[model samples]
Target chain A: DAPLFDRVAFIGIGLIGSSLARAVAHHNLARSTVCTAKDPEHLEVAHGLKLTTDTAPTIAEAVRDADLVVVCVPVGAYAEVAEQLKGNLKPGVILSDVGSTKTSTVRDLAPILPEGAHLVPGHPIAGTEHSGPAAGFAELFIDRWCILTPPPGTDPAAVEKVAALWRAIGSWIEVMEPEHHDKVLGITSHLPHLIAYTIVGTATDLEEDLKQEVIKFSASGFRDFTRIAASDPVMWRDVFLNNREAVLEIMQRFTEDLTALQRAIRRGEAETLEALFTRTRAIRRAIIDAKQA
Target chain B: DAPLFDRVAFIGIGLIGSSLARAVAHHNLARSTVCTAKDPEHLEVAHGLKLTTDTAPTIAEAVRDADLVVVCVPVGAYAEVAEQLKGNLKPGVILSDVGSTKTSTVRDLAPILPEGAHLVPGHPIAGTEHSGPAAGFAELFIDRWCILTPPPGTDPAAVEKVAALWRAIGSWIEVMEPEHHDKVLGITSHLPHLIAYTIVGTATDLEEDLKQEVIKFSASGFRDFTRIAASDPVMWRDVFLNNREAVLEIMQRFTEDLTALQRAIRRGEAETLEALFTRTRAIRRAIIDAKQA
Candidate 1:
């Protein structure tokens, strides 16, 4: 395969960041890869794992001469990263990201883009419940959809280049509007995580022995939620914080729908419950048909 | 290990039933094992898989001459299963079940149990998302929990016999009141499944392109819900129908809590959202510590 980028710099070496770094390194998608995280320990792990060709000590140093600088940090840190990278990026460099929400990302990072540099915000719709550099694998993004919501009038060549990089890592790329991406992901990713967090929280408040029983019997259904709820607290905290409006808007619809079902359940409305369940099975079937199951 | 019973009969040979049959067959927990399902195809699979020593087509034929009979059908099928087995069961037979709900088990099965027949209800809280006899494995219950909700004045020997069988299959047993068992499972099992079904159902209502995208991008978080929602619809339909009150009650709490978080997200109440996400993380830890993760 042709090298997709001359060099790629990773701004934060956590799960998604590390996964991208690993994929870029493993598949030789880039001629060389370098990464830097805010935490020294994480950088040390990147060094130990040989996650990239170089582990830079600071974000600016990492982006200094790279053709592609992918911001892989929490969205909450977008401004800090953008501020730090504003001056050091090479001319014609491409700035992209794997943050969950795109609108907030553009709001925070676009104004700071250096002249002649291109900004393309992307979200690779892939992750495991596990986090951190070690948790990353080359296949994490394989066959997954990566949404790139570049602002209109952005250089087509830059968008193509970034799209080429993710495609090299085995993702199908689609261009979407920033607002639409947020609204859609707010329903699919953000709301699901929020529900998992809340239900697990409800389980936590149970009496001690009952709580143990909940854990013991978790395989019935709660195990899935625990795995999800175990995801990096800081990162998810940033997600729910940064994607506030869109997340909340969709969440409103979700709650209202949930309440109607709840009332039906309370009234022993088996038909209502069964109808919903049967409809969901069709979605699962669609996922299987899409081969993303 | 001591053999727990002279003969064990299983009514309704689906995933959970076939798994218990496999466990019994593997561990030599009973002198003989027999199973039957209302669906002939499932019974044929049970026989073809050799999940039991004997297979019958009727619930009455299944329990006749047996010392122990476990009802492994859907909870909604309990009344009919109990009614069918009422006159056909041998004297002193132990009638138990592996239903998700407990209160309804007693309400449906207890009265129909014949004199000298012991009713020691049970729920071996282990399963996979898959269904049917072919999907079962002997290790399904290993290191999982088995909760027995024997009503007051229920025969202790019958309860012990069931517990011993589960123990031989590598389960830790908990004896609790039927109502308490239902409540804990309402949070852990029933509510989780309902939410999974609901969210997956919500995504099912999306526009064609968006729905396709939701499935293609499911790995973001929606994939887990798909797996859960892919679970046997009929089994789940019965679970919700039979466990109506407990599931609805807990679902009410879940929706209210979800609403508050939705409000936080809409209002951009970062603190409220972060705090709950943080608190939920602690529960995931507790579950992991309990070795349920």
Candidate 2:
């Protein structure tokens, strides 16, 4: 069968980008694919793995004749990348992304988009602590949710095209308003990553002896935080910076709740602790019932 | 071959208790085993699973004439259970426990220990979020750390016997001072559980719409915290209450660190965020190297 797009250009080939590239190739979602990265080593690794039909040395070169351009760089780097893609994108090209924060994606890429071009920003809610091109897999998005937040007035056909590609690659697509997307992910994704990074950072500052023992006995619970903290630093840093408002709001609630629990522990209020814990278990059950656990 | 212990009694056949009983039977570590629980349903489950040779209705009946008695109840119930075991233990009986807080174990079990009996408190660094007798398996302790915190001046023979039984069940034994064990676990286990429970509780308090969205997108990061938070509520409540000082101290350190990171995010201190994230990654590597991940 003919491919979905004549050509697909990936502006950055990291974990999510590389995974999508692999999936597109495996599922024949695109006729041909090309990827570019600021890091020359990543480009070489992408070439080594045959991640795409071609490797481009720059964003301009990658998106030169492509019908679709997916911005896969860190959110913090979007402005710089958008600057490069301003005059290079093909006419009527559909631009999309695989970023964690949607509001930031639109804020960064919308202004640079050409008049006839379509912008469909997507956030695939899936990943591991590992990063880089080699860390990606073709099945990473299988059965995962991929949310698209297109600015109002976007072409339905363009939005549907992007959704169809993700669906072909094995993702369940959900369309949401950008602001609501950021707020929901602030609690579900951003806040959890922040807390994990902070707790793991706390252990990093412990005295040498205690730190060693902490790692030795990490299987109990701390190991989970370490794994989350091990995710790409630049990607996460960009996420926090871009979603500051929503993240800070949820974090404020988290801190207040933590303080209450701390007080209960200090005062030996066993019932309060048990009550909150039991209530939280219901959330776990809900996640399981939703088949998201 | 003769069994390591002629008779072993299990006080409170819950998750840890039943696992130990199953391991004892599987490894032939004891010739005969008896278990008792304050919850009659738990006793019935123990009998149905054949977790022990016999199920006794009370602690006194369970420990009567047993050569070894392993306390597997929650830390909060230790003192009361100790009261019941005061005169029921056989002479030369080696008393042990599998509780989270080491200092509290020594404080509660040592006073009621028989004149010739030994007290060796243990905490196995392993478990799933599930609880109850049916949730346990014989291999729960395999390749896991079983920390034994015997009070100073405890009988050497008794300590060795307890250590040997754990070893026979495929556990690596680590001897530690009661105070030190609590301090180490305060950071590794208690503090993480508190953070998880707090974060999940925070989401539990969100508005109805957002709360459902949180569960739906939980696989991004929130699901992990949910699993940890889903752990037995009564058990964790007792943990925080019994390990108050150590938990509070570590929590103070964690809160201060979190506050600094929060400040950095507010100020858009990208360098600060990136540096801490990179450092935390090293700890994850160390854990992987230690084979703990």
Candidate 3:
């Protein structure tokens, strides 16, 4: 594989950031790599892990003279990142992001980007329940999907370079509108996490005796939701906050559907319950057949 | 390990049944083992895998001379299984079941059991998502809890024998009243699966275009719920049907709590949402500390 960039800078080195940093280093995607994270301990761990060739104390310092700049921070941090990278980015530098939401990212970062710096919003639909720099690995993106949402009329070469880098890291690429991507992910990802967090939260509020039993016997099914809910709370809070409209819209639909289900269970409508239960099994089969299982 | 039973017969050969069969076989807990299933194909698979020493053509044949009989079919078939085993079971045979719910099992089979035979209802709190004879592994029960609910003032030797059998199969045993076990499991297992099945079903009803996208991007969180919802429907149907009171009771609490959370989200009550989410995370940490993670 050829080096995609002579120099690349990372704005935040969290789970996704560190993972991509490791992947870039492993694949030699860039000749020189640098990163800056807000948290001091995280930066220390990233340095210790050798996530990039150099660690910068400031975002502007990190992007100086870099041919590529990747903003791998929480969606809420996009404006701050773009502010720091404003005049420091090299001419013709491709500015990209690995955020969970895209519309807000484009809206937040595009305004602050300097002339000759390209903006390409992206989301790698891969993550574990864990977070932090030390929890990352090069294989995190293997066989996963990386979606790019490039504004129309954006330079095609900049898009291709990012796509190629992701492909080299074992991801398949798709270009889509930011709005469509958010809506699609709202139902598949956002709503599910909200529900898991809600149900597990419900169990937590149970009477003390029942609560103890819930943990003791969690292996049944509740435990899986707990694992998902155990994911980094601040990161998730940022996700829900940045993608508010889409997440709220899908959460509405989920609540209505859940209400219907609750009524069915209350009414002992076994047929409706079983029919829905049986139909959903086919999707799991489809997922297995699609090799995503 | 000492032989726990003179003879033991498994009535169905699937993931749970075959795992128990393998454990019993590996540990020499039973001198002879036999199995039969409603589906002839499963029998063929069991026979091909050599799951039991004698693969009987009928349930009656399998239990005719056995010292212990375990009904391993999906809970929906419990009544039929009890009917079949009633007349054929030996006078002193200890009859038990490996089901998700105990209250209903006692209700369905206790009345049908022969007058002199001992009933020591048991449930091994262990399993993987996979099913079928091929999915069976001998170590599935290791370090897991197995709950037994024997009726008031039944034979102590019968309960001890069943506990010994589970111990031989590498499970820690606990004895509880039927109602308490039902209530505890309702909060732990049944409610979680029901919620998972409902949410995954909710996603399946999305528009065709969005449905495909849901599957494509499911790695976020929905995928876990799908896997849990894909579990055997018949077995779950029986679980709900059998543990109706406790399941319904806890489900009421869950629905109410869910409604509260939904209201909180809609009202943008971030503090409430964050607090509940934080508490749940603490519970997750507890589970990890307990070595159940």
Interface RMSD of each: 1.6, 0.6, 1.6
Task: Kindly report the root-mean-square deviation of model 1 from the true structure over all alpha carbons.
Answer: 2.1
lDDT tens string, model 2, A70-127?
9888899999999999899999999999999989899989999998999999999999
Candidate 3 residue-wise lDDT, A225-275, digit = tens? 899998877667667766678887877776677678767767777787778
True contacts kept of 1: 0.70
Q: What total of clashing residue pairs does each candidate reach? A: 0, 0, 0
* Order of the predicted models by lDDT, top scorer first: 2, 1, 3
**Regions of candidate 3 where Cα sits further than 4 Å from its true position:** none
Candidate 3 falls in which docking quality class? Answer: medium
**Top-DockQ structure, candidate number:** 2
Model 3 chain A worst lDDT run, 10 consecutive residues: A234-243
Q: In candidate 2, which residue ranges exceed 4 Å CA deviation?
A: none
Candidate 2 lDDT, B5-24, residue by residue in tens: 99999998888999999999
Worst 10 residues of 1 chain A by lDDT: A250-259
- Considering only chain B, report the TM-score of each candidate against the true chain B: 0.96, 0.99, 0.96
Error of 3 at B258 (Å): 3.2
All candidates: DockQ:
0.66, 0.89, 0.62
Number of the candidate with higher DockQ, 1 or 3:
1
Residue A73 lDDT (model 2): 86
Q: Number of the top candidate by TM-score?
A: 2
- Candidate 2 vs candidate 3, DockQ winner: 2
